[model samples]
Target: MAKEIVCRDAGYDCDFMIRSENEEELIEVVQQHAQETHDTEMSQEDIRGAWKTV
Candidate 1:
């Protein structure tokens, strides 16, 4: 099963899907989520850190 991570943006839960076995892919998914869904700008470093636990 794919691992899922929820992030809060604008006081809403932004659900992001992260497939296991790849950290980079998860990071990219999170970046897109933050930009398209959350409308919050995140730095590359922040994105990397977010996916660290997922």
Candidate 2:
């Protein structure tokens, strides 16, 4: 199944979502979006544990 994560679920005021064939790629884009738009840096582990990103 493809993985999807929503930025708003992380407590950010923006609504950014990414759906990828693999979790690794999804995490990378999510991290990039966070850094570029939110000015926040997060690791893959952090993203996984932060929410029920399914």
Candidate 3:
């Protein structure tokens, strides 16, 4: 089974949900979540590599 991580940041009411088939994917999701939802600066390659599964 895979794990899904739900993240929410200050100043935002909507919660960003991400599902990963593995740990690697979760990492990517976290980065994307931070960048897109949280407004944190992140790189595409870093996010891509963070994926654990397709």
Sort order, lDDT high to low:
2, 1, 3
**Any residue pairs clashing in model 1, and if so which?**
none
Q: Estimate, for each residue in 1-54, the C-alpha lDDT of model 1 and write its tens digit.
A: 343445643246545455555656766777787788778787767755454343
- The lDDT of each candidate is 0.60, 0.77, 0.59
- Model 1 ranges off by over 4 Å: 1-4, 8-11, 17-19, 52-54
Error of model 1, residue 9, in angstroms: 10
Off by over 4 Å in 2: 51-54
TM-score of 1: 0.55
Where model 3 places Cα greater than 4 Å from the true spot, the runs are 8-12, 40-54
lDDT of 2 by residue, 1-50 (tens): 66777778777788788767777777888889889998889998887776
Q: Model 1 Cα RMSD, Å?
A: 3.8
Distance from true position, residue 40, model 2, in Å?
0.6
* lDDT, residue 11, model 1: 43
Better of 1 and 2 by TM-score: 2
Candidate 3 residues 1-54, lDDT tens each?
655544442334667667767666667667767877668864655555443342
